[model samples]
Target: MASAENESLDHVPLFPLNAAVLPGGRIPLQLFEPRYLDMLAGCLREQRGFVVVLLREGSDVGSQAVFYDIGTYVRIVDFQQLDNGLLGITAEGLWKVAVNRSWRAPDGLNLGDAERLPEEPEDVLPSGHSELAAVLRALLRHPVINKLDLSVDFSSAREVGWRLTELLPLDSQEKQRLLEIQDPLQRLDRLSSLLDAMD
Candidate 1:
Protein backbone atom coordinates (compact mmCIF):
# COMPACT_ATOMS: atom_id res chain seq x y z
CA MET A 1 0.00 0.00 0.00
CA ALA A 2 2.85 2.37 0.84
CA SER A 3 4.59 1.74 -2.47
CA ALA A 4 1.37 2.15 -4.39
CA GLU A 5 0.62 5.40 -2.59
CA ASN A 6 4.07 6.82 -3.21
CA GLU A 7 4.03 5.86 -6.88
CA SER A 8 1.77 8.75 -7.86
CA LEU A 9 4.46 11.45 -7.62
CA ASP A 10 7.75 12.14 -5.87
CA HIS A 11 8.05 15.87 -6.38
CA VAL A 12 5.64 18.82 -6.31
CA PRO A 13 5.63 22.58 -6.17
CA LEU A 14 5.33 23.85 -2.59
CA PHE A 15 2.96 26.60 -1.53
CA PRO A 16 3.81 27.88 1.94
CA LEU A 17 0.98 29.42 3.90
CA ASN A 18 0.31 30.53 7.47
CA ALA A 19 -1.83 27.44 8.12
CA ALA A 20 -1.67 23.68 7.79
CA VAL A 21 -3.96 21.52 5.65
CA LEU A 22 -4.69 17.97 6.72
CA PRO A 23 -5.75 15.06 4.58
CA GLY A 24 -9.46 15.16 3.59
CA GLY A 25 -9.39 18.93 3.98
CA ARG A 26 -9.95 21.83 1.61
CA ILE A 27 -8.90 25.42 1.36
CA PRO A 28 -9.20 28.35 -1.01
CA LEU A 29 -6.31 30.44 -2.30
CA GLN A 30 -5.85 33.53 -4.39
CA LEU A 31 -3.00 33.40 -6.87
CA PHE A 32 -1.36 36.66 -7.75
CA GLU A 33 2.37 36.09 -7.60
CA PRO A 34 3.90 35.27 -10.97
CA ARG A 35 5.73 32.20 -9.67
CA TYR A 36 2.61 30.66 -8.10
CA LEU A 37 0.50 31.56 -11.10
CA ASP A 38 2.82 29.52 -13.28
CA MET A 39 2.85 26.63 -10.83
CA LEU A 40 -0.94 26.50 -10.68
CA ALA A 41 -1.13 26.60 -14.47
CA GLY A 42 1.26 23.66 -14.74
CA CYS A 43 -0.74 21.59 -12.25
CA LEU A 44 -3.98 22.28 -14.08
CA ARG A 45 -2.50 21.53 -17.49
CA GLU A 46 -0.71 18.36 -16.46
CA GLN A 47 -3.40 17.21 -14.02
CA ARG A 48 -0.83 17.18 -11.23
CA GLY A 49 -0.97 18.62 -7.73
CA PHE A 50 1.15 20.69 -5.36
CA VAL A 51 2.18 20.59 -1.71
CA VAL A 52 0.73 23.06 0.78
CA VAL A 53 2.99 23.54 3.80
CA LEU A 54 3.00 25.90 6.74
CA LEU A 55 5.51 28.69 6.61
CA ARG A 56 8.04 28.29 9.38
CA GLU A 57 9.80 31.45 8.40
CA GLY A 58 9.49 34.35 5.91
CA SER A 59 6.50 35.62 4.00
CA ASP A 60 4.32 33.63 1.56
CA VAL A 61 5.67 35.80 -1.28
CA GLY A 62 9.30 36.79 -1.99
CA SER A 63 12.52 34.89 -1.25
CA GLN A 64 13.73 33.14 1.92
CA ALA A 65 10.39 31.57 2.85
CA VAL A 66 11.11 28.43 4.83
CA PHE A 67 8.40 25.76 5.28
CA TYR A 68 7.74 22.92 7.66
CA ASP A 69 8.78 19.46 6.55
CA ILE A 70 5.22 18.10 6.48
CA GLY A 71 2.52 19.13 4.04
CA THR A 72 -0.70 18.06 2.29
CA TYR A 73 -1.24 16.96 -1.32
CA VAL A 74 -3.73 19.31 -2.96
CA ARG A 75 -5.64 19.18 -6.26
CA ILE A 76 -7.48 22.11 -7.66
CA VAL A 77 -11.20 21.35 -7.60
CA ASP A 78 -12.66 24.71 -8.67
CA PHE A 79 -11.27 27.94 -9.97
CA GLN A 80 -12.35 31.34 -11.26
CA GLN A 81 -10.96 34.73 -12.08
CA LEU A 82 -11.58 37.25 -9.31
CA ASP A 83 -12.69 40.74 -10.15
CA ASN A 84 -9.19 41.99 -9.36
CA GLY A 85 -7.94 39.50 -11.98
CA LEU A 86 -6.32 37.17 -9.41
CA LEU A 87 -6.89 33.47 -9.86
CA GLY A 88 -9.14 31.98 -7.15
CA ILE A 89 -8.63 28.28 -6.60
CA THR A 90 -10.39 25.84 -4.30
CA ALA A 91 -8.02 22.96 -3.59
CA GLU A 92 -8.92 19.73 -1.84
CA GLY A 93 -6.27 18.21 0.39
CA LEU A 94 -5.79 14.56 -0.51
CA TRP A 95 -3.10 13.18 1.79
CA LYS A 96 -0.26 13.92 4.17
CA VAL A 97 3.38 13.90 3.06
CA ALA A 98 6.82 14.32 4.56
CA VAL A 99 9.08 16.53 2.51
CA ASN A 100 12.63 15.17 2.36
CA ARG A 101 14.29 17.97 0.48
CA SER A 102 13.48 21.13 -1.43
CA TRP A 103 15.02 23.89 -3.54
CA ARG A 104 14.02 27.15 -5.16
CA ALA A 105 13.39 27.41 -8.87
CA PRO A 106 14.53 30.38 -10.94
CA ASP A 107 10.99 31.69 -10.75
CA GLY A 108 11.19 31.46 -6.93
CA LEU A 109 8.80 28.52 -6.69
CA ASN A 110 9.91 26.00 -4.06
CA LEU A 111 9.82 22.41 -5.27
CA GLY A 112 9.77 19.64 -2.67
CA ASP A 113 10.72 16.00 -2.96
CA ALA A 114 8.24 14.27 -0.67
CA GLU A 115 7.10 10.80 0.26
CA ARG A 116 3.53 9.80 1.10
CA LEU A 117 2.89 9.05 4.75
CA PRO A 118 0.78 6.02 5.51
CA GLU A 119 -2.75 6.87 6.58
CA GLU A 120 -4.08 5.32 9.72
CA PRO A 121 -7.04 3.00 9.49
CA GLU A 122 -10.51 4.04 10.53
CA ASP A 123 -10.44 2.77 14.07
CA VAL A 124 -13.48 3.24 16.26
CA LEU A 125 -13.48 6.49 18.15
CA PRO A 126 -12.47 5.56 21.64
CA SER A 127 -14.84 6.55 24.45
CA GLY A 128 -14.31 10.24 25.15
CA HIS A 129 -13.19 10.74 21.61
CA SER A 130 -16.77 10.89 20.40
CA GLU A 131 -16.84 14.35 21.89
CA LEU A 132 -14.40 15.34 19.16
CA ALA A 133 -17.12 15.15 16.58
CA ALA A 134 -19.43 17.10 18.82
CA VAL A 135 -16.86 19.83 19.23
CA LEU A 136 -16.20 19.96 15.52
CA ARG A 137 -19.89 20.06 14.73
CA ALA A 138 -20.21 23.11 16.93
CA LEU A 139 -17.31 24.82 15.18
CA LEU A 140 -18.77 23.97 11.81
CA ARG A 141 -21.79 26.08 12.59
CA HIS A 142 -19.76 29.27 12.38
CA PRO A 143 -20.50 31.44 9.34
CA VAL A 144 -16.88 31.68 8.22
CA ILE A 145 -15.88 28.02 8.63
CA ASN A 146 -19.23 26.73 7.39
CA LYS A 147 -18.25 28.04 3.99
CA LEU A 148 -15.44 25.46 3.91
CA ASP A 149 -18.19 22.89 3.16
CA LEU A 150 -16.49 20.09 5.08
CA SER A 151 -17.94 16.61 5.06
CA VAL A 152 -17.74 14.66 8.27
CA ASP A 153 -17.46 10.92 8.93
CA PHE A 154 -17.99 10.25 12.61
CA SER A 155 -17.31 6.53 12.34
CA SER A 156 -13.65 7.03 11.47
CA ALA A 157 -11.39 8.32 14.20
CA ARG A 158 -8.79 9.36 11.65
CA GLU A 159 -11.30 11.41 9.74
CA VAL A 160 -12.58 13.03 12.91
CA GLY A 161 -9.04 13.92 13.99
CA TRP A 162 -8.10 15.50 10.68
CA ARG A 163 -11.29 17.54 10.59
CA LEU A 164 -10.71 18.78 14.11
CA THR A 165 -7.13 19.72 13.29
CA GLU A 166 -8.28 21.68 10.29
CA LEU A 167 -11.14 23.45 12.09
CA LEU A 168 -9.35 24.58 15.23
CA PRO A 169 -7.78 28.01 15.25
CA LEU A 170 -4.39 26.67 16.25
CA ASP A 171 -1.29 28.49 15.12
CA SER A 172 0.71 27.18 12.21
CA GLN A 173 3.35 25.52 14.40
CA GLU A 174 0.75 23.74 16.50
CA LYS A 175 -1.10 22.47 13.43
CA GLN A 176 2.17 21.33 11.82
CA ARG A 177 2.99 19.36 14.95
CA LEU A 178 -0.33 17.56 14.74
CA LEU A 179 0.31 16.75 11.09
CA GLU A 180 3.55 14.97 12.05
CA ILE A 181 1.86 12.63 14.50
CA GLN A 182 1.52 9.14 12.96
CA ASP A 183 -1.11 7.73 15.30
CA PRO A 184 -4.68 8.76 14.71
CA LEU A 185 -5.88 7.97 18.22
CA GLN A 186 -3.03 9.88 19.77
CA ARG A 187 -3.71 12.85 17.54
CA LEU A 188 -7.34 12.74 18.54
CA ASP A 189 -6.51 12.47 22.20
CA ARG A 190 -4.07 15.35 22.03
CA LEU A 191 -6.56 17.46 20.16
CA SER A 192 -9.27 16.68 22.69
CA SER A 193 -6.90 17.69 25.47
CA LEU A 194 -6.02 20.91 23.70
CA LEU A 195 -9.68 21.72 23.24
CA ASP A 196 -10.36 20.93 26.87
CA ALA A 197 -7.63 23.32 27.91
CA MET A 198 -9.12 26.04 25.81
CA ASP A 199 -12.47 25.53 27.55
Candidate 2:
Protein backbone atom coordinates (compact mmCIF):
# COMPACT_ATOMS: atom_id res chain seq x y z
CA MET A 1 0.00 0.00 0.00
CA ALA A 2 1.26 3.47 -0.83
CA SER A 3 1.80 5.74 2.14
CA ALA A 4 -0.23 8.94 2.33
CA GLU A 5 2.93 11.00 2.00
CA ASN A 6 3.62 9.58 -1.42
CA GLU A 7 0.05 9.67 -2.65
CA SER A 8 -1.45 12.56 -4.56
CA LEU A 9 -4.74 13.56 -6.13
CA ASP A 10 -5.01 11.85 -9.51
CA HIS A 11 -7.70 10.98 -12.00
CA VAL A 12 -9.05 7.43 -11.60
CA PRO A 13 -11.83 5.46 -13.19
CA LEU A 14 -14.99 5.28 -11.11
CA PHE A 15 -17.65 2.57 -10.76
CA PRO A 16 -20.85 3.55 -8.98
CA LEU A 17 -23.00 0.90 -7.38
CA ASN A 18 -25.83 0.79 -4.88
CA ALA A 19 -23.49 -0.82 -2.35
CA ALA A 20 -20.49 0.57 -0.52
CA VAL A 21 -17.16 -1.15 0.20
CA LEU A 22 -14.72 -0.09 2.88
CA PRO A 23 -10.98 -0.56 3.00
CA GLY A 24 -10.12 -4.21 3.73
CA GLY A 25 -13.47 -5.43 2.34
CA ARG A 26 -13.92 -7.25 -0.96
CA ILE A 27 -16.71 -7.27 -3.52
CA PRO A 28 -17.44 -9.41 -6.55
CA LEU A 29 -18.62 -7.60 -9.68
CA GLN A 30 -20.05 -8.75 -13.02
CA LEU A 31 -19.31 -6.58 -16.03
CA PHE A 32 -21.41 -6.69 -19.19
CA GLU A 33 -21.65 -3.07 -20.24
CA PRO A 34 -19.26 -1.83 -22.88
CA ARG A 35 -18.14 1.19 -20.85
CA TYR A 36 -17.26 -0.84 -17.77
CA LEU A 37 -15.75 -3.64 -19.81
CA ASP A 38 -13.36 -1.16 -21.32
CA MET A 39 -12.61 0.29 -17.89
CA LEU A 40 -11.81 -3.17 -16.59
CA ALA A 41 -9.44 -3.81 -19.47
CA GLY A 42 -7.58 -0.55 -18.89
CA CYS A 43 -7.25 -1.18 -15.15
CA LEU A 44 -6.02 -4.73 -15.63
CA ARG A 45 -3.55 -3.74 -18.33
CA GLU A 46 -2.15 -0.91 -16.24
CA GLN A 47 -2.13 -2.99 -13.03
CA ARG A 48 -4.08 -0.19 -11.33
CA GLY A 49 -7.36 0.10 -9.44
CA PHE A 50 -10.62 2.07 -9.65
CA VAL A 51 -12.89 3.77 -7.17
CA VAL A 52 -16.10 2.05 -6.05
CA VAL A 53 -18.53 4.77 -5.01
CA LEU A 54 -22.02 4.30 -3.69
CA LEU A 55 -24.64 5.63 -6.07
CA ARG A 56 -26.78 8.43 -4.64
CA GLU A 57 -28.99 9.17 -7.64
CA GLY A 58 -30.00 7.69 -11.01
CA SER A 59 -29.44 4.13 -12.17
CA ASP A 60 -26.20 2.16 -12.28
CA VAL A 61 -26.83 1.21 -15.94
CA GLY A 62 -27.18 4.78 -17.13
CA SER A 63 -24.89 7.77 -17.76
CA GLN A 64 -26.50 10.22 -15.28
CA ALA A 65 -25.76 8.50 -12.01
CA VAL A 66 -24.54 10.50 -9.01
CA PHE A 67 -22.37 9.07 -6.24
CA TYR A 68 -20.95 9.88 -2.84
CA ASP A 69 -17.59 11.56 -2.96
CA ILE A 70 -15.89 9.22 -0.49
CA GLY A 71 -15.28 5.73 -1.76
CA THR A 72 -12.94 2.76 -1.68
CA TYR A 73 -10.13 2.29 -4.17
CA VAL A 74 -10.08 -1.36 -5.15
CA ARG A 75 -7.72 -3.55 -7.14
CA ILE A 76 -8.86 -6.46 -9.21
CA VAL A 77 -7.53 -9.50 -7.41
CA ASP A 78 -9.06 -12.10 -9.67
CA PHE A 79 -10.98 -12.25 -12.93
CA GLN A 80 -12.57 -14.88 -15.13
CA GLN A 81 -15.19 -15.34 -17.82
CA LEU A 82 -18.41 -16.62 -16.32
CA ASP A 83 -20.51 -19.29 -18.01
CA ASN A 84 -23.10 -16.64 -18.83
CA GLY A 85 -20.44 -14.80 -20.86
CA LEU A 86 -20.06 -11.89 -18.47
CA LEU A 87 -16.73 -10.92 -16.96
CA GLY A 88 -16.51 -11.80 -13.27
CA ILE A 89 -14.09 -9.94 -11.07
CA THR A 90 -13.14 -10.02 -7.38
CA ALA A 91 -11.98 -6.65 -6.11
CA GLU A 92 -10.28 -6.02 -2.77
CA GLY A 93 -10.55 -2.55 -1.28
CA LEU A 94 -7.11 -1.07 -0.77
CA TRP A 95 -7.88 2.29 0.83
CA LYS A 96 -10.23 5.24 1.12
CA VAL A 97 -10.23 8.21 -1.25
CA ALA A 98 -12.24 11.39 -1.56
CA VAL A 99 -13.32 12.38 -5.05
CA ASN A 100 -12.60 16.10 -5.44
CA ARG A 101 -14.13 16.41 -8.90
CA SER A 102 -15.56 14.16 -11.56
CA TRP A 103 -16.23 14.03 -15.29
CA ARG A 104 -17.36 11.52 -17.87
CA ALA A 105 -15.35 10.09 -20.71
CA PRO A 106 -16.74 9.93 -24.23
CA ASP A 107 -17.40 6.26 -23.66
CA GLY A 108 -19.68 7.16 -20.73
CA LEU A 109 -17.23 6.04 -18.06
CA ASN A 110 -16.96 8.22 -14.93
CA LEU A 111 -13.55 9.57 -13.95
CA GLY A 112 -12.60 11.38 -10.77
CA ASP A 113 -9.71 13.30 -9.30
CA ALA A 114 -9.28 11.56 -5.98
CA GLU A 115 -6.98 12.14 -3.03
CA ARG A 116 -6.06 9.15 -0.91
CA LEU A 117 -7.06 9.47 2.71
CA PRO A 118 -4.68 8.61 5.51
CA GLU A 119 -5.01 5.10 6.86
CA GLU A 120 -6.23 4.60 10.38
CA PRO A 121 -3.47 4.00 12.86
CA GLU A 122 -3.08 0.54 14.30
CA ASP A 123 -5.12 0.15 17.47
CA VAL A 124 -5.94 -2.93 19.48
CA LEU A 125 -9.53 -3.81 20.24
CA PRO A 126 -10.27 -2.56 23.71
CA SER A 127 -11.47 -5.00 26.33
CA GLY A 128 -14.85 -3.27 26.49
CA HIS A 129 -15.36 -3.94 22.78
CA SER A 130 -14.65 -7.66 22.90
CA GLU A 131 -18.32 -8.29 22.17
CA LEU A 132 -17.98 -6.55 18.82
CA ALA A 133 -15.26 -8.95 17.74
CA ALA A 134 -17.30 -11.90 18.90
CA VAL A 135 -20.28 -10.69 16.93
CA LEU A 136 -18.16 -10.29 13.79
CA ARG A 137 -16.70 -13.77 14.19
CA ALA A 138 -20.18 -15.22 14.35
CA LEU A 139 -21.33 -13.20 11.33
CA LEU A 140 -18.34 -14.34 9.28
CA ARG A 141 -19.40 -17.95 9.77
CA HIS A 142 -22.43 -17.50 7.51
CA PRO A 143 -22.05 -19.54 4.30
CA VAL A 144 -22.24 -16.52 2.00
CA ILE A 145 -19.60 -14.58 3.93
CA ASN A 146 -17.42 -17.64 4.42
CA LYS A 147 -17.29 -18.15 0.66
CA LEU A 148 -15.68 -14.74 0.26
CA ASP A 149 -12.65 -16.12 2.15
CA LEU A 150 -11.98 -12.85 3.89
CA SER A 151 -9.07 -12.42 6.28
CA VAL A 152 -10.04 -11.43 9.81
CA ASP A 153 -7.92 -9.92 12.53
CA PHE A 154 -9.91 -9.72 15.72
CA SER A 155 -7.05 -7.98 17.46
CA SER A 156 -7.15 -4.99 15.14
CA ALA A 157 -9.83 -2.44 15.81
CA ARG A 158 -9.88 -1.26 12.21
CA GLU A 159 -10.26 -4.79 10.89
CA VAL A 160 -13.14 -5.60 13.20
CA GLY A 161 -14.93 -2.31 12.50
CA TRP A 162 -14.59 -2.54 8.73
CA ARG A 163 -15.70 -6.19 8.54
CA LEU A 164 -18.69 -5.56 10.75
CA THR A 165 -19.71 -2.56 8.64
CA GLU A 166 -19.60 -4.74 5.54
CA LEU A 167 -21.37 -7.72 7.11
CA LEU A 168 -24.09 -5.97 9.08
CA PRO A 169 -27.51 -5.11 7.65
CA LEU A 170 -26.81 -1.40 7.69
CA ASP A 171 -28.06 0.88 4.92
CA SER A 172 -25.68 2.35 2.38
CA GLN A 173 -25.84 5.76 4.05
CA GLU A 174 -24.93 4.28 7.40
CA LYS A 175 -22.05 2.33 5.92
CA GLN A 176 -20.81 5.42 4.10
CA ARG A 177 -20.80 7.36 7.35
CA LEU A 178 -18.67 4.68 8.94
CA LEU A 179 -16.27 4.70 6.01
CA GLU A 180 -15.78 8.45 6.36
CA ILE A 181 -14.86 8.18 10.03
CA GLN A 182 -11.12 8.44 10.61
CA ASP A 183 -10.93 6.82 14.04
CA PRO A 184 -11.30 3.08 14.34
CA LEU A 185 -12.29 3.13 17.99
CA GLN A 186 -15.04 5.65 17.29
CA ARG A 187 -16.31 3.51 14.44
CA LEU A 188 -16.44 0.52 16.74
CA ASP A 189 -18.42 2.51 19.24
CA ARG A 190 -20.87 3.52 16.56
CA LEU A 191 -21.23 -0.08 15.41
CA SER A 192 -21.90 -1.19 18.96
CA SER A 193 -24.67 1.35 19.27
CA LEU A 194 -26.13 0.20 15.97
CA LEU A 195 -26.04 -3.45 17.04
CA ASP A 196 -27.69 -2.63 20.31
CA ALA A 197 -30.50 -0.91 18.47
CA MET A 198 -30.85 -3.84 16.07
CA ASP A 199 -31.47 -6.25 18.91
Each model's lDDT comes to 0.84, 0.88
Candidate 1 deviant stretches above 4 angstroms: 1-8
As for candidate 2, its clashing pairs are none
lDDT tens readout by residue for model 2, 1-199: 3443454447689999877778789888999999999999888776688999988888888899988999988888888999999999989988999999999999999999998889898999999999999999999899978877899889999999999987898887898898889999999999999999999
What residue runs in model 2 are displaced by over 4 Å at the alpha carbon? 1-9
Give me the displacement of residue 168 in model 1, in angstroms.
Answer: 0.7
RMSD of each: 2.6, 2.1
lDDT for residue 75 in candidate 1, whole number 0-100? 81
- Give the TM-score comparing model 2 with the true structure, all chains together: 0.93
Candidate 1 lDDT, 1-199, residue by residue in tens: 1233544555589999987778778888999989989998888787788999999989987689988988888888889999988889988888888889999988889997888888767787787777888888898898877887888788788888888888798987888888888898999988988988899
